[model samples]
Target chain A: MLKDITLGQYYRADSVIHRLDPRTKIVGTLVYMISLFLFNNLICYVFAAVFLTFVVGLSKIPPKFMFRGMRSVLFLLVFTVIYNIFLSTGTVIVKFWVFTITYEGIQQAVCMLIRLFLLIVGSSLMTLTTTPNQLTDGLESLFKPLKIFKVPVHEMAMMMSIALRFIPILMEETDRIMKAQIARGADLENRNIFIRVKSLIPILVPLFVSAFRRAGDLALAMEARCYHGGEGRTRMKAMSFSAGDIVAWVILAGYIFAVVFLGVTFKTFPEFLVLEMKAGLEYLIPTLSAR
Target chain B: MDIEVRNLTYEYDSGTPQAVRAVDDVSLTIPGGQFVGIVGHTGSGKSTLVQLIDGLLKPTAGSVYLDGEDIASRKFDRKHMRSLIGIVFQYPEYQLFETTILKDVCFGPLNMGLKQEEAVNAATDALLRLGIPRESFGASPFEISGGQKRRVAIAGVLAMNPKILILDEPTAGLDPGGREEVLGLLKSLNESGLTIILVSHSMEDVAKYVDRILVMNEGKIFMDGNGKEVFSHVEQLEEIGLAAPEVAYLMKAVHDAGIPVATNITTAEEACGEILRALKN
Candidate 1:
């Protein structure tokens, strides 16, 4: 049951998306998030959707698997849509005793839901295709420019990579400790919720203690290896941007431009113009009817 | 409580691309009141087999019968089953978090649904039996020595009043004196009619304490018999990266040196006596 959790899960596949430099993927994800918010029209949404679909297909990552990432934040997405529909005010389409449902409210709610869903899917695409080590390496290299500010960029990347490496180890340890407690007749499941929460104290305290102990040991080991930040440290595998990376960047940039252009020209400007024309027509229609 | 594993098979990461068969189809009977020692190198399925018996792991196929009842049956109470078969995992002392030794020991019986008074009584009795002082019961478990901490952990399991007890590498990382003390405690527990299953790397301890030895290799049972019978196949044991009991090795060496000594000797005391008799002759 614990194994099904896909937080920081990476799917191994030999595809162009998987082969792109981790640095490229990270930057691409940031740009994709920006483009998702830039699109306000249905046409722009369609363009973004089709682009994501093509990337997902090229990555060979199943669409069903990508959707699984949405399951965790599914409740939040629902909450956002429901709140937007009820609270947003515009031209009322349906009116009750005190509440009004507007046409624009429905539109805003749908757009908000789509935006949140796309954000999760796009970020998940980055994590699914990149290994934790590679991601950290990319972050360190990207942050190399911050050396001017002395931000300890390399140390931060090293720490992240180490944390990722120890996740499985800690998981296995937790499993063992949980079983040990169970053997001692600790009924973690059968107790009342309050008692269950209290019982976790026993498990959590030891887990934290051991984690700190491991961290201390790891620090000492790293020190013994003469690890003094990333200064003068040469990497075993050099990061190189290949032809696939360049093509990926080009396609992503083109897709973002199209989404932004369509959103502005078709959705925002047309909606503004239509509202203005509606006001003018309202006055003309009343006069014509009077005549 | 006897544990009967019938056609038991387990696969790690089942249904995943990285799936591996850790425990292949196997059948074994661990009779009530018998002390069985399981020995294997790392990744030999010995640990997996023990976890199956204790129900820490559910087999992918087949069933585990505890005293003629299928443990995997929906009607079975898992907590009750676990209480009945107490398991002391390797280096289990690391799990100790209770403020006092008594409270830590009482944790198990309380989980078994005993009243606070009854749990305290059981914990007291267990600590006393394990040679911990009544005064030490009130002290923090963390304040004790490593050996004392280990005994406290074992006493924690003992407090549950299990009919069958399983220990994984109980003697690991212990000094010779501490090892003997812990093994002796287990031997006494076995003598009192509690079925014991011990998984360990120390062939000497197993030969000295257990009635039978099970040799595991590559997720399959390689051999299962009385200590003398299992240790007699010196060549096979060594082939699988396991050494026979030192007494058995000494006996075999003496026999091969043209002495008429028996090669199946398992205990050090018996080997000493036999060597004395051979010298006199």
Candidate 2:
């Protein structure tokens, strides 16, 4: 029944993004997110939206799936929008009850919402396209320079991989425990907040007990197989910088260069681009909706 | 405690790309106080059928009638129905979380609104029914042997005092001796007038105990009959990824080798007796 949770948001499909080297995707996502924060006005925001949509389309992951990750942070987005809309000062659009909505407030809210939406979608695409194992591998390679500072980077990656693996197992365990209690007539639904929290004790106790047991078993199994620390460990599949990865880096660099250039151009010629974007949107939105 | 299922079907993820017709158009009657066995290959809708029977899952279509009353109706007392028809899932032993064996067994009865003393009494009675020793009543369920923990788990359900007992693989993971012990208790319980629905993958266990057998295949009841009648159709059962009891196959092999013996034997005891008689002749 709890299967509706599409968390970890891994969209499974055959696409260029899915096949891209995890390092490239990771760095690409970082550049994408950094540019999202760098964009200052409507013109750049529109370009950013276009860029994100293009990447999402190329990834072949459903738009629904990419936005599904946004569902978890929807409240934060709304709160930020409301906070910025009501609290910020500019040419007032309306005034009511110690609150004022300004034209600037509307612009900030829209820009913030778009940024939040793009942030979630961009990150979700990376996770959805790259498997957890690949993510761990990418992180390990990216943090390799820290190994000189005595960081157990390999060990950290292994821990992450194990944690990622246990997520599904723990989810199944939780479902079973919840059902077992429910079958015994433990009412999980229709409880007040306090009682609901208390009702979870039955689930928590068994879950903790099982988790400990599993961890202990895993440790023993690892020891029995003569596993030590990650000091001299070697990977079965070593990471390589492929042609696809180079293409991804080049595209990402171009995107950052465009955003930086756009930011400078916006600083120098704000009125020209802003007026043109306003007119384009005013023309485009109605036609899009009519279609 | 008669259960009549009428054209029941359950679909998981209905209308999705991965939609599954788990139990499709299945209808059957479980007579009062009878030991019936449900057998099928994994994912053959055996578990789905039992879960539907207990109202744990609502059917996508059709109804389940208990004593001619439709249990699936919106107004049915779901809690009372669950109390009346207890379901012990596979590996129920893993569900034990109470501090003591007695406490663990009492959970169900207490949940049904019994007083503390009454719940304990019900739990004790159930434990005794399964031959669990009273000396171990106060012991932690975690401290018990694997087989004992399973008994304690079953006792927890039996404490509810259900008229119909539904077990999915009650003897699963038990040693041969533990399996026989569990089956013996089920037999006695059936004799004492509890309608028992046993879902199992072990055809030998089913043949040894259950009077009637239901074979599920591709989300439907492919075969329904007494042990003899159902086991006789070996080919049909095999086609659906099931086989008759080894004893029945032994008898069939002997019969096919030109020996004059009954081919429908479903128990080792009966098959041995027939083979001995054939040897003597």
Candidate 3:
């Protein structure tokens, strides 16, 4: 059951996005995240959504899986929408005894929800197409100039890649330890909250012990093989930007331009415009509540 | 506790492109109270097959029957099944993390819902059976010797009072003396009516202790018989990357050298008796 965890899981596939330089994908993802918060209008959101859909298609990752990823954060999305709807101050659309739903509140809630969903989907696409090794290589290359400031870029990338590689191995160890505990009659299921928390001790303790043991063994093995802090080291597969990477950059630039143009031209949505016009008519007509 | 596997098949990473068929259309009935040894090269499905018997794995196809009840059935409680069949995994010392040897050994019984006092008593009895000192019960397990730690880990499983004990390479990485100690404990457990299924690459250990041997190759059982019968087919066994028991090989050489000694020898003592008889003739 633990195997279903797909956080930062890379699925290998031969596609345009998968073929793009890892450096390009990494930089593009950063740019996309920055641009998400920059655009606020409905037209810009539409443009962003379309651009994400096109990229998702090119990556050959099923839309269903992307939606599945979003499902994990669905609870937070609903909570945000509900909180904004009742708590924000604006012209009331619906009035109860003490609670009122406002026009601006609904607009902000929808915009925020869409923004969060797109953020997760866009970043997930980057991870899904790029291997962990390639991603780290990209990070090292991108941050190589920082070495002038003595930032230890190579060491950081090496550590991150090693950590990423061991995640699955550690997860597998955790599963084995849990099974051993279960065999011993530790009931992890159908217990009270306190008991359940206590039950995890058996699994976690062994997991940590084994993790440390593996780390020590790995260090010795690396040292025995003469590994020394990534200095004067060369890679077998060097990173290079291809034609596909350039095309990807061009498309990303076009997406940013479209978002910027739509953000400037579209001041308000038609639905909000209609709501304001209706409120103006309400002011002209006398209401029984006003009496 | 007899384990009856029927047409069992398992696939790793099922539904993914990287899926692999680890176990395929395999079925075997391991009789109750028999010390069965499973031998296979790495990745030949020995580990996967044993895990199936204890319900650590559910077969993609077919089922496992323990004491004639389908273990995969919804009516069957897997946790209770696991308690009935104790599996001491390879490098079991890695599973040790308790503050005291007693607490670590008592883990199984406590999980079985035994009272604290009852669990402690059971752990003590198990430790005594495994030849661990009673005074060492309160000591940290990490401070113990490697062999003692392994015994303590096995005692943790023995504390559950399981009927069938499945050990995966119990003697792996141990010195000869340590290997003998662990194997001797298993031999005593078998004498006390506990069924043992030992998975190992050491043909010598299996020849000395196991009642029956099951040889696996490429995810299928290549041979299943008593030690003598399995070892007698030295050529076939060697073809699958397994060698006959040393006694068996020596006897085969004696027979090939024109001696009328029996080739069905598996243990050194049996081979010695055969050689004496041959000399008398």
Q: List the residue pairs that clash in candidate 2.
A: none
**By summed lDDT, which 10 consecutive residues of candidate 2 chain B come out lowest?**
B10-19
Which ranges of candidate 2 are over 4 A from the true structure? A268-291
Q: Write the per-residue lDDT of candidate 3 for residues A164-255, one digit (tens) a residue.
A: 99999998898888777776777789559999998888888888888888999999999999988868999999888888878888988888
Error at A125, model 1, angstroms: 2.3
Question: Clash pairs of candidate 1?
Answer: none
lDDT of each: 0.85, 0.85, 0.85
Q: Which parts of model 3 have CA positions greater than 4 angstroms off?
A: A62-68, A88-92, A97-99, A102-104, A265-291, B72-82, B217-222, B229-243, B246-265, B268-281
Query: What's every prediction's RMSD, in angstroms?
Result: 7.0, 5.7, 6.4
DockQ for candidate 2: 0.57
Q: Residues B34-115, candidate 1: write the lDDT tens digits.
A: 9999999988898888899888888999889998999989998888887889899999888998899999999889878899
The TM-score that candidate 1 achieves is 0.87
Total clashes, candidate 3?
1
Instruction: Tell me each candidate's TM-score.
Output: 0.87, 0.91, 0.87
Task: Write one digit per residue (lDDT tens) for candidate 2, span B17-81.
Answer: 55799998988888899999999999999988988888777789999999998987788887888
